[model samples]
Target chain A: MAATASLQTAPVPEGAPITVCEVGPRDGFQIEAAFIPTAKKIEIINALFASGIRAMQVTSFVSPRAVPQLADAEAVLAGIDRPEGALITALIPNLKGAERAAGCGVDAVHTVVSASETHNLKNVNRSIDASLKDFEAVFTLLDNSGIAVEGGIATAFGCPFEGIVPPEQVARIAKRYQDLGATSVGLGDTTGMATPATVRAAVRAIRAEAPGLGIGLHFHNTRGVGLACVMTGLAEGVTHYDASVGGLGGCPFAAGATGNICTEDLIYLLNESGYDTGVDLDRLVGAARLTQATLGRELPGQVLKSGPRLRRYDPGLTATAAG
Target chain B: MAATASLQTAPVPEGAPITVCEVGPRDGFQIEAAFIPTAKKIEIINALFASGIRAMQVTSFVSPRAVPQLADAEAVLAGIDRPEGALITALIPNLKGAERAAGCGVDAVHTVVSASETHNLKNVNRSIDASLKDFEAVFTLLDNSGIAVEGGIATAFGCPFEGIVPPEQVARIAKRYQDLGATSVGLGDTTGMATPATVRAAVRAIRAEAPGLGIGLHFHNTRGVGLACVMTGLAEGVTHYDASVGGLGGCPFAAGATGNICTEDLIYLLNESGYDTGVDLDRLVGAARLTQATLGRELPGQVLKSGPRLRRYDPGLTATAAG
Candidate 1:
């Protein structure tokens, strides 16, 4: 198929991998039962950077008690020395978080609001309008500090509390974020309730509503539809995606909610489908194995547990192949 | 999208749920390690039937030592007494197996051959030509004995051992089975290597080769493309599908292979998409629970653990309200 007009046409350097943002430290850690140490969080961020994932979301700057897992966000940012040209993003839930992210000399501050009213109220204890008001200030503060601002629309696909969320509503919210000078908009499957049809429809509507705004898809594999949703986004000309390292993370309200799509598996799918997701599968596996060892548990990522699809028989060459 | 020929023109009664054949007890169990007892096998099949799944694959008649899981196949067939209209199928690998299936009074005898020569050799321990020769007698016996015969093409999509089985080759093998008077044919993704593009190509090719034979898709969820393959099959006008209860089956060769597409999940998808799958989601979950309890282990179906998209609240009132 010809390249769709919605995708950026800037030709990638021959065989260069697509830029995959590893959100395990942020998205994955934020939902876990254990409060991972800032030092270990820094180790994960550095490991992911070494894995060829240039873009990483290391920590969320929520209130210390709200997501205790990320209470040491500042310490994590202080400990890690990022590579040149690497983008490290932090999830900023309010103006306070945005100020901290800007002060940390981070590449980006990402603020999340929900498309569903019930979820928005349940998530941040604020109405949608109240959350938007907070985000507006966060955007302005980040812009004045010359830091990039990414607005995330949670429950962009569907809401567990309120069943189906209209695509137009998601687009409307995203457009408002763009109007407020956000650099990019991320669509999140907060509840893992998206089908390929719904994902495509929402992405198409968002693109039409906010032209030239980079739209990224963040999915949870709750219903085992994470990669399928990613494929839908890919078919709709989306290149940027957010994946957790070991499929770690779950929505507090979505019953039986699972983790985000595994980075290794997502990279495998993209590589197999002939996309350039510039991630090294082996390196991602190494990071996952490290995280798994740290946590003393097996993760849900298939590729990490099963190994890469094709194993080559070379005594000297250690390169594994895709299935 | 407008309904295709099967959806638009099938002569079945209006509002009747489409049938899904649960193949877990038979096809799934035969391949893997879990050696479930005859009582447990009957329990699983009975639970599935109670879940509004009228048809199921109860067992396979391969040699006892070859597949020890179904060693008590005859006992399993004799044990379960289900609804009158409910049909149970048995997979028979050769003429002796078919004779046993006929003696056991199965509703259908399913014989499988491979589309790829290398896959056939690896799978059945016989070449494609030898398998065809064996299937000829099986088909002839079924034709004379008034037993329904369904032909399955293993590795119809692609093979792990032998890459990318040609569509024409699949059609040719399917035609040979049809010529021998097989009543229907099922395209097997033995390795779960099918994509939408490949499924569309193979289905279209096979339809042209054998217009009268009913074609079903038996897919594995190994590569996470099972549902995508199903959608392609649905688009190509296929009405019958074979899924395992709780996604039970996987290819022995494919180490990371999860089970086949779960029957409850597939039904949920079809129902949500406005297609009618007669199985009740809650009842399907109940069946999955029973199987899991019997085996004392967790199975892979997600919808069973997590309630259906449409949760039932005030069940008694809802039933009365429907009345």
Candidate 2:
């Protein structure tokens, strides 16, 4: 009875559209061993935009020496057609990267601060405190640039180096981001260690600490609970999510980490659950196919492999209806 | 506030241990292309038992011509060491298979009825009504055998040919099984089209139709929502779940059907969410390894590849504490 009651209470309200922030260009491609040509990256980003993804993390403005794969970030930013009203964001690590992203005219710049000190050091070559200090300067750079700042706390759910990050610690970091002029903050399951319980607890903690700040969830399917975590996040009223096109991307530092939540898969789930994602399933699958072609490999995405469940075929029904 | 309230109400009740019914030996091996030796099958079942799986579907007593993979059901049943208090179940197609399973000393026999008439014809080479008629004789054979009966309704969520299966149809079939002397009924997502909403609706419908009957859920990771469906099932208070070691098992008839939910992955989720599965993670991983070795291919299970998340290692803490 309690279970049924809970289900009734958490029903997805009619026509409540959720925003799926595509991170394939940034998160998904960052781990590639070979450098994807700048033109190809632009083509994929434009394809995603055509597929009705209005919000996306296009590329990261990091040191070329650090991540050679994303070395053409500036070229990609300049080459792609940025449709009016689209929110194009870029990941920035420090003040220099933020300045570079701002100059590239991104709608928003995302900065990262891991909850675990070890992970933060491994990810950005700086401690969490040092990253926060760096963010102060980065935030100052975007003060009058019309660029929104988003703070992403990596390893917010669980860390590869520091497992089972405390919800209080994540809350504190999120609250600090709010205090530092971030428009929103995202909880990153860096190693895909997030369970439904952990996702719910993190949401509650973050919401409690920063009441009006927008919260997004970034999940990986490494241990195969990415979408489950997303479901919990949805029940917690989280409408923003970060996903890759073909379930691409893996954490280089985290052992066994593989693939963010697949974009088409997440969109399929949202659409089936009666949430409007504004993304066309067919076009999205096309983009996923392009991603596979660009990478010249099979992707981990399912919808691209298995098309959406069609309506039942009736012999009496016309071919048009069946089609 | 509503999201937080919903989460609080649905918190996994303290100390409510969930039963994970391991179906790897039956479901996993049934899909293998190679004929696994009877001794290897028994060895895997024993290894699963050693991993603290108290209940398992060991083998299927189907026609050897129909499914040669499970032809050695009697040999596997006779060879394995059936631990005390373990529920050793076997799949039975009809009266003959049920009689064979009963004679072979299986603690229970599972019979399947597809909700979709098309799938029923394809699977059992009989109509739904014909299967029901056959079940009558099978029930009579088990009338006083002291062996329990479990009815598995395939395509209870959706069918490959029929597409969406109405909740009422699944409920009607489940109620029929309950009326025909089944101790419990499992709703099989044969084509993996089940969403959280559908799962909740099916649970509600079945509970309404067959009050006080045990309900179990069988899911496929075809579209990568198997674990998510499991989460929704857990929220709806359905404890018993069917999973395969190494994520083995695929519906040969269902297009694009992939592996079943991995046993180790499911155990990891249950354990992290505070549900006692009575399964040792290490031993279960070992069993998954054995499954891979027997199959001679990599399986889809993740926890078998990625170890459980360990706590943050502190330099001040001892190695044992860190470990």
Candidate 3:
């Protein structure tokens, strides 16, 4: 029977708005081969905004020739109409990318550094120290441009090359970013090698080291543990999450890496658990469907295919709880 | 970084041995057209036993014509030698089936009942009460027969025809079975429609009503939430999970349901998290590989395809902790 009183006793402090930072348009499109039209990118962002996704990573400001899929980043950013109270973000690899993102009138600029020295060299062709030095310039550029800057640590959980990243190394890089005046830090399981226990340990260690910093998570469901890690983050008192629409994303290092946790499905999960995420599941699914059609392939997010559980059922068959 | 003082804390008292019960040779083979040789089943069972899988739902003692795949159940059981500590289980539908299972000299006889009246009617062409009445005869036949009896609650999570199942209904049936002196209760999510929240609620309610009953879980990863549900069961202190070796089972109702969670991967998660499941990953993966070759189709288990996380690295490059 449906409990007359809800069994949801674990209450978070009242009136905390959990932020769902959308990374699909940037992260999702980057990995896929389909060179989506700039208009399609704008359309997807507009759709996300309509579905109550206020903050979105619209496009990456990387070198156009480097990432041809998002070559029209500036054009796409300019094409989408910004609804009221919406924040658009972009990824910046270096000072040049930061300048490009700041010029696009985006709300925030995200720069990333890999925790593993091997992955760091492969990712950006620079050592960890050299990447940090490069980021110093990117940080100064974003700081002078009056735009919010966020530091993302990729391969934070475990590295495909190095394997089993030590927590102290991740914390050390995070601390360095915090000292460099980053507004927030995003931890990425770039290869999806994290388990719940590892996630818990990492979160505990990071919180002990950097208590005041705003922390977010970017997880790829490569090994199918992305959602579990997300739950661990929830248990660790994290309120902000990063997800790609249609679960679209891939690791450059690991072959056959799966998509990120689907944004539509994640929204459905959070909203069903009495967490207010503001995103409309149906609208998100519609955008996901559009993206799937544009890509000409099936995406990994199951909720879009199966539909949400509670939404499909007739109220007469299942008992509704008395509020 | 490794804690200077080896962060290996005192082992938390393991709640109970989470039975990685295998039902593949029975439940998995029954629906397939592939007539696996009797020797193959014996080989599979012997490999599973070697992997420290103590309890195995080896075969179903159904009529030969009804399930031709398991028609050689008797021969398969006779061919395999049971390890001293293993609980070799056989599924029984009625008194005749129980007698047949007893003739096979198995450790336990498992019987199933549907909580939804409509599903019970459709499945066995009998009402819920009629099925329960049949259970009475089976229970009477097994009493003092030196064989343990376990009851399975199928479609406990959600039914295709009836939709959502209430916790009270699940608990009431479990209570009835426990009151009738069932040795254990196994909850089956036949349709894979359960979320972690629903699992937590239903399991808690059942435990509250049927205290001291050995509760086990049989989850299908059809909806991609199977592992998440497993994590929920772990948190709620429920051990004894039933999984197919290569996630082999399928749903008759849902057209393209995903298979059960892979046993090797499940053991990898549990063992890596410091739970003493005692299953050797390499042996289990070898068995999975053999099954895949015998079936001539790729299985859904990740570790079988990609190997474990440690397998990703070269032996020379891997650290001792990961090894």
Candidate 4:
């Protein structure tokens, strides 16, 4: 267990509060080919909240024709329970999406801008500056409506098309978002290109630029280091994290691969590391199992399959040979 | 990408050296139900060496009747290629296994003892003290044979049956191994129960108790925090790690799940973080693909499916919609 050889890091604080925001219904479901029924989506969301999940990016408000998977965003928002202290949010593309989300009474809306130019153009069919310009209107619409806005910078780690995004570029966007009244800014590992070094650089740059904005890490477990990135995030003192249930999403480029980090797995890590996530592991696993069954596929969530670490076994069970 | 927050870890040094040892053939293959052909095993072992793996636990010298899958351990040792600087080792149960390993010209031998009494009794059918008594003969046989000995403490973190395996229990075993001429001690996450707290505690205890013994970390990604555990190891300044190709192994208790941390993913994290591993990720992926093809089912490695983080795409392919 002694891993002391390189990378001298300070101790990770125990008993700290980490906000594990569930983005499964939006980020995880957006790429799923099958449209989960509106009622089913509400059931899953309600289950998550019952398990002590306080912050969640519940769904995305987009054009139904463009993304039919989330065409029932408003229905899902209406059908779900409003638990005390639960912060329900959604991803919004433009002013229309923002208006729809506000009408549905969401607590907040997330806005994204890619750090790299080419990726920005491909993802949203607009330049980074144009996306920012469009967000100004969305921000204004929700300014006095009690809806907090979180600015999400996609491809903040590295862009597949334009590798090694500079930390300064991400910081500039964060500065703009802060100036536009964003309560927090999230760094999205859109293609799972985030590494410890890149994460350190981008985090340090943003802290130097926008000291007032809260930082949330939204990482994808694409390359198997998603939770490892979360480890770095915890070390860096960032509390907010984004995860999906049962690892429901897959990358558009990497077919049949996991997308965002699994929510159950994230909670397991946080709870074990002495960070208070306020989640019940059994209930969260149940939620993950529900998602996996609803999707009719094997998920990439290891904890959900393995159960909790201390889960006992009968020694009499066979196949336990080692030598 | 910015992850600065709670843990005040110092800077992770770039361009440092980390020794990533492959244990797929031994710890991984021993658990497989089907017996891989000797030639195929040799091919996979050779491919791993060709990909610049400097250290490996090639096979185990247990009774053929005990573990049929690894019955051809001697044949595998004889048939595989040994490139210069590749340290080949194997698991030895007792003096007889040590003698067989010495006969196979292994560079080292790893001996196992569970930190928990129940797990020890279930794993090797002996009490903890009885297992140590058995290892005494192993150390004596390999003392002057030019084969280094590594003590492996199973369930060093926590145990499924016993719940929590105290760090003192693990360190006491490590001290016994050190006193018995073991050059290093490896803390094994046999049931994927290692957390950062347990890892830190065990590592600190060993360092305090046996200052001269080198430490190696053997972690399982069963609960999805295996790589995160590695992050803790790096911060603690320990360099040696054990992994499996394609994440071939699965926990015996958890049906159809990943066991060891993926070698390719570990190499990718280490290499991207500026640690020198001398591994070509593409070659490692090729090796994983070979294992997957050989197994005729999917393995749990994420980098094996997602490729390297900066892997480029043409954007001409469809399904790239986002906002």
Candidate number with greatest lDDT: 4
Best by TM-score: 4
Q: Give the alpha-carbon lDDT of every model.
A: 0.72, 0.79, 0.73, 0.84
Candidate 4 per-residue lDDT, tens place, B1-323, comes to: 00100111233366766788899988878877888999999999999999998888999988999889889989999999999878888998888999999999998888889998998888788999999988998888877778889888888998778899989899899899989988788888987888887888888888888776788888998888999999988887777889999887767878756789999999999998889888988998999889888888888898888888877877655524442
C-alpha DockQ of every model: 0.14, 0.29, 0.18, 0.57
**Local accuracy of candidate 4 as per-residue lDDT tens digits, A1-323:** 00100111333468867788888888888877887899899989998998988888889988899889999988898899988877888888899999999999988888888998988888888899999999999989988888888888998998878888999999999999989988688888888888888887888788888886778888888899998898887777777888988876667767656788999999999998888889999999999888888888888898888998888887776525442
Identify the runs in model 3 with alpha carbons over 4 angstroms from their true place.
A1-17, A81-83, A144-146, A252-257, A310-323, B1-16, B252-254, B312-323
Tens-digit lDDT string for candidate 1 (A1-323): 00111244232232444567788888887767777777787887788888778788888888887778888888899899788777788888889988888888888877888898777766677887888887877776766676888878888887766778899999998888888887578888876677777887888788788887777778777766676666556557676788899777764433554568788878776665556665678988899989988787877776675455443222232211110
**C-alpha DockQ for predicted model 3:** 0.18
Q: How many residue pairs clash in each candidate?
A: 4, 0, 3, 19
Q: After superposition, how far is residue A19 of candidate 1 from its true place, in Å?
A: 5.5
Q: What is the TM-score of each candidate against the true structure?
A: 0.83, 0.92, 0.88, 0.95
Place model 3 in a CAPRI quality band.
incorrect
Candidate 1 overall Cα lDDT vs. reference? 0.72
Between the candidate structures 1 and 4, which one is better when assessed by lDDT? 4
Q: Write model 1 residue lDDT over B1-323, tens digit each, in one string.
A: 00111221223332445567888887767755767877878887887887778677788888998778888989999999777777778888889999999999987888888887766765666889899898888877877665788887887877656567889998898788878887567888776666666777887787788776677778777656576566656656767778988788765544644668878778766665556676677888888888778767777676666565534222122110000
Query: Per-residue lDDT of B146-264 in model 2, one digit per residue for the tens?
Result: 88888878888887777888899988887888788877887787766788778888888888888866778888787777888887877777778888898888744334445688898
Residue A195 of candidate 1: its Cα lDDT? 72
Clash pairs detected, candidate 1: A17-A278, A18-A276, A18-A277, A18-A278
Model 3 / residue A248 / CA error / Å: 2.0
